[model samples]
Target: MYDIAVVGGGPAGLSAAVQARARNKSVLLVSGDVRDNPLYRTERVDNYLGFYNRSGRELLEAFRSHADAMGVQLREGRVLNILPVGDTFYLSIGSEVEQARAVVLATGVARGRKFPGEAEYLGRGVSYCATCDGMLYRNREVVVVGRAADAPHEANYLRELGCKVTYVSAQPPEGLRPDIPFVKGNRVEIQGGRNVEAVRVDRATIPCEGVFILRSSMAPDDLMTGLELENGYIRTGRDGATAIPGVFAAGDCTGVPLQVSKAVGEGQVAGHRAAEYCDAQQREEKTEDKERM
Candidate 1:
């Protein structure tokens, strides 16, 4: 298993991996290609400190180069699900699953604005990641929460694979010309406790077996069912610790003042702490072995 699997290729994730590796810990960066910091689309990053006039893309390229120089393995694939088992975490990436001791999510903010219990029943019923849970709801009633090419694309997929889908929108899903259950309503609420029973809409419960919460684009939280997140950000303490052990988060995903300097500072702290924790575990095991011998 990898020492750490940094789940997002953004500034925070990249910096964290480097920090961990600098301490002699092996690191693996599991990120999709487009996740290399969307700020790269912007014209300038003057407020980012040191880079007085750097383009987002240029800075990202430099960051990537640095990560590569340090021998961090980079894998390309959209993260579909992150399963935490004991001390290791498993990431589902399009027919493949990767395991790691820790994960740092920097997948950015999810802004689909399609609400209520959408957050509550994330794993119970509302799931943003289709790739992971799509199979579970085969030929069952499933509602996908999203718009743009991403949402409809997923909806079409479910439909193609024989899922009864309702495209509930924050806004109408774009470019999807599929024959499926497309419910045009907001305020997506998941009703039920340990198991999801139905999705509450404006006037009805759109009775379904499953609800795929696709809000906007993917966030670090959406991929990890048990990771507590709110408003498209991965909820973390000041120390960057998440509800999920061994998984740390930083930067905008942890919420705003999303400056480059802030991300770097948080990344440093998370890196040091995670490394220390992993190191301590190793030492404990070594001691235990000696005692047994």
Candidate 2:
């Protein structure tokens, strides 16, 4: 088990891992494969302390390199769930389960709006990670909701999984490659109460075995469950503590003041707090061992 496992490759997760290591703890950094960040491509962030007018990507890369230089072990995996076990935390990352003394959930959200029945069929027939669930619908028709450049690639991913994909768009396909059939509409609705029975748009029912929502923007809670969220942000304490012990969440997960610099500062505090928590655990283990002997 690692001393700390940070569940994001974004700004906050990276910063937390670096500081945790500085406190001499074993660190594992897990991230989704969104290497080409969508936010960095558009925004011009000039309020940053250094680099008066630096692109977000330029700033992000520098931090990534710093974490790499510090010998932080980077692991690529999409976290599905995080559960607090006895004196340890277990993270369900796709097919693997990782245990760590401390956990930092820095997975920034990839969700837009919370629609009814959206979370009900979470793993039933509806899924988020197409790569993981696409195989189940092999040779069957599937639907993708969203009109970003990611639509084509997501469709391709489903195709590679041996499933026929139909890209559903809330808007007319713009600037995107025009190879796949883009079902253009204003609002894409998933028509069902409990499990995804069908997708309805203007009295038209498009039947599908599965539905994958790929909306462009994301909010904080879009990543993990079992957290107290207030206005789409993870709630935290003055000590940077969360509801779960040994799971010190910081940055956007703790919500509010969602800026890069503020996030980094919170990360440093969480990292140190996690380090202290781990150390206390180790000392307790030693005492227990002595008593056993």
Candidate 3:
């Protein structure tokens, strides 16, 4: 288990991981494919202090290098869920689970709102991680809603798993298996009663037993319940501490301006505070043990 788990690899998450490592805490930074990060695609970023006229990818690479030098463990995957039990936060990344004493949520703004009936059937017949639920739908029909950069790959995986996979997205999917049919649709909705019966893609309705809505980043609140939000952003204090103890938030997930500088500053605060929280938890556990004796 790590002392802190940062759920993003953008400027904020990298900064948080670096700060936590600076405090002598073990940190695990989990993020999706780099191509999915908004900053990675930007042509130029001139606002960040001391890094004028640098491309977003260049700045991101620098941040990643700093975090790597600080001994922060990096994992590439989308965090499907975060369950806080006791003082430990259990993060479900794909089919694996990681434990941490504190969590730093820097998941940039989750683009697009939920589709109709998406939330109602979240666990019934809908899922986010194809790796985790692919086997269940083997030989069964399923729709893969392609949103992130790796969605096509996931669709291909499902097809390989013997699932009759149908890929649906706003644009045509690249790298999708030729056998897997692709549907072009901008407006999509999940439809079902009791369980997912089908997915409605624009003018087409495809019958399926399961639907995988793959997105680069799940909303902070969706990942962890009880996370307070203000105007669609994760609400946080100046120190980046959220209402949930031992859980802090920073960067675009916390609010606007959404500048690289703001993200880095907030990340520093969140990482430091998370490290302190871990220390306090350790102290409390020690005290309780002594009292028990």
Residue pairs in candidate 2 whose N, alpha carbon or C atoms collide under 3 angstroms:
111-218
| lDDT tens per residue, model 2, 76-185 | 65676677778988877755788899887676655456555567777766776666677889988777775344556777777777776767776664444454566766
What is candidate 3's lDDT per residue for 49-100, written digit by digit as tens?
8989999999999899999999999999999889999889999999999999
TM-score of candidate 2 on Cα atoms, chains taken together: 0.84
- Name the Cα RMSD for model 2: 3.2
lDDT of 3: 0.94
Candidates arranged by lDDT, highest first: 3, 1, 2
Return the TM-score for each candidate structure.
Answer: 0.70, 0.84, 0.97
Candidate 1 per-residue C-alpha lDDT over 37-58 given as tens digits, one digit per residue, 9 for 90 to 100: 4666767888877788998888
Lowest-sum lDDT 10-residue window in model 1? 213-222
Better of 2 and 3 by TM-score: 3
Q: By TM-score, rank the candidates, best first.
A: 3, 2, 1
Locate the minimum summed-lDDT window of 10 residues in model 2: 215-224
